[model samples]
Target: MDVQKTEIWDTKMVPRMSQFRAFQQVLDRTHSHWDLKNSNDDHYTAEVRRHTVNDFVFTELAADPLTGNRTISDIRQSDHHYFCLLYLEAGDGVLRQGPNESKAAAGSIALWDSTRPAFFGTHSQFHQFSLLIPHEVALQSLPGIEDLCGLNVDGNEGTGALLLSHLRQLHDTIDTIDTQDRPAILRATVDLMAAAFRPSEEKIGGTAFRRALLTRVQEHIIENLGEPDLGPQNIAAAFCFSPRYLHRLFNQFDMTVSDWIKRSRLFRSRSDMETPYLDGLSITQIAMKNGFKDSSHFSRVFKQEFSMSPRAYRNQAHNLRLS
Candidate 1:
C-alpha cells in the first residue's frame, strides 16, 4: 500500500458494502500497520478525524466495535515506529502488548508502542483520542517510559486527572497557541505522562521527576494567571515547594517562572484581542482579563512581544479576516 503524509485535519467516513476495506486502508495510512476485523463488515461505520499538532498527530475516532492485531511481520512492514497514547473519550476496550494487558474504560488513558506486536478489542461503539509521539522523542523525554506500555491510567483523580485536563485543554485551545509555543506544549505532554506513570520507587530528584514538576508548575501558572496573587511566592506555596526550588526548576528549562506567567497572559490576551467575538471589549479589558493590572504596562509588553500595539494587532487581524 502507498502511504502519504496526512493532512492537518483529515476526515474519512466509511461507505456501504466495501467490506471495511476502505476503513482499514485509511486507518493504516493515518495510524500504523493493522489487520482489522469487525462483525458488521457490511454495515460497519467509522469516522476518523486526524489533526496534526506540531510533531504529534492527534486523532479522534468514532466507530462501531472492532478488533485489530499487529504481528511481527506487520511491524516490520510499517514505515513509522512510535509510542501511542490513547484516551478513551467514550468506549471500553482491551489492549494487549507483550505480556501486559489492560482493560480500558471511558476516561482512561493507555500507552503502547508501535514497534511491538499488540492486540486491541473494543467492547462497544466508541469515541477515542489517540496521540502519536515520535519514538526517540518519547524516550528522550522519559527514559524507560516504554515499561508503562499497555498500562491504563485512570483519569478520575490525582496526576491522571491533571494529565487528562491538560490534554482536553490542549485540544480546545490549539488554534490559539503560537507556533513557537507548540514545542513547549508537546514537551509538557510527555512530562505529564511520565508523572502519571513513573514507578513508585523513582526518586524525587530524577530527571523525569523534575520535568514533571516543571510541567505541573507551568500548568498552575496558566490556570491562575488571572489572579492578582499569581506569582512565584503564591505558586510555590500552593505546590508546597520553596520559592527557590520553583525558580530552580524553571531555570532548567531556560525560563524564569515569572516571565512565563507574563508570557502566557500576553499570549492569551493577544488571542482574545484577535477574536471577532471579543471585539466589543476594549483593549484594556482584554489586558485585565488576562492578568494585566496596568493598561500601559500591558501595551508596552504587547508591542515588545509582537511588534504592534494590541489595538493595531486587532485591527490587522480583523482586516485580514474581512479580506
Candidate 2:
C-alpha cells in the first residue's frame, strides 16, 4: 500500500534535555496524554513511526525503559475514544486498567482502552507495534470488547498466534500492498483480533471461537474452489479438527458442509455466466471450472438457485446489456 508514514518523534533530532518534552508533545498530537518516566536522563532515546491505513492507525515504537499512564484527566481531555491492541516484539511490561492487570512478555498482546484510565510500564529496552482502532469500528467485529481491556492474550499459540503472525507480516509488507486493498486488509485484521480475544469455551460455549474459525474456513474454501478435491473431510483436516466436529460447526448456521460448498460453487458459476468476457466459455466449461464435474447436475442446481437455467440467465444479461 505504500502506506504514508511519518516519523513523529525521534529523540536524536533534539537536544538531550529537550528529548522528553519533544516526545510528550508528539504524544499529545498523536495519542492521548501520557506521563512518561525514564531512569537515565542522559541516555533516553525513543522513536515512533506512524502509519495510517484507512481509518486505523499503526504506530511502531522503539525506546528505552519507561513507564507511562493515561490518567483520568487525560481521558477527560481526549476527543475520540480508541481501543488499542499492542503487539509486543521485545521486552516485558505490566499493564493495568480498572481492576484488571497483567504482566506481558514478548510475543504477547495487550488491549488498552482510551475511554478509561490505564497504566503501562516497560522494565527494559522495548520494541512494539500498536494498532489504534476506533471504538465504533472495533465494536463491529468485537461486541464484548470491554471484557478484553487490561488483559494480555498469549500470542504464541492457537488463534492468538495466527493473529499476531498476520499482523507481523502486514507490518513487514505494508509498503507493497496497493492503497485500494488496505481497507479489506484492515477489516480482516480486525476480524482476526476479535477471534483471538473470544472467551474460553467454558464461558461462551465456544460460540465466538466457532464463528471465527468458520469465517476462516469459508475464506479457504473460496480460495480453493477450483480444486476438485475440496470437501468437508479435507477442510476439517486442514484446520486440524475432526470431520464430525466440522459438521457440527456448520450445523450451528443450519447448513451442511456439502450443501454450503455446492451453493458456493453454483454462485460463482452463475456470476461468471453473467459476465460478458466469460461468454466464450461453454456451460460445461464454466461448471467444471467451479468444481462441478457433472454439467447436468450443475444446471439443475443453478435453476433451483436462480429460478432459471444458466444459459437463460446469461442470455438475459446479454440482452439487457445490448439494450
Top candidate when judged by TM-score against the true structure: 2
Q: lDDT score of model 1? A: 0.79
lDDT of 2 by residue, 1-323 (tens): 23354556688999998887788777766767887887877656888888776557778888888899888888777756689998878899999998789897899988888988889999999998988887756754664467678998888899989988998998888768888887788888888898888656564455656767876887788888878888988999999999999888767545788887887888688768767788899989999999998889889999987678898988987896677
lDDT of each candidate versus the true structure: 0.79, 0.80
The ten-residue window of minimal lDDT in model 1 covers 1-10
So what's the TM-score on candidate 1?
A: 0.60
Per-residue lDDT for 81 in model 1? 68
- Against the true structure, candidate 2 reaches a TM-score of 0.62
TM per candidate comes to: 0.60, 0.62
Off by over 4 Å in 1: 1-15, 202-323
As for model 2, its CA RMSD to the true structure in angstroms is: 13.5
Off by over 4 Å in 2: 1-5, 201-323
lDDT of each residue in 1-323, candidate 1, tens digit only = 11113433222333478737877877887888798999975676788777776558777788889999999988877755689988888879899988789998988888999989999999999888888887756754554566678888888999999988888887677667887777788888988887787655453334756767776777777788788668999999999989999988866445687887887888789778767889899999998888999999999999997778888999987896677
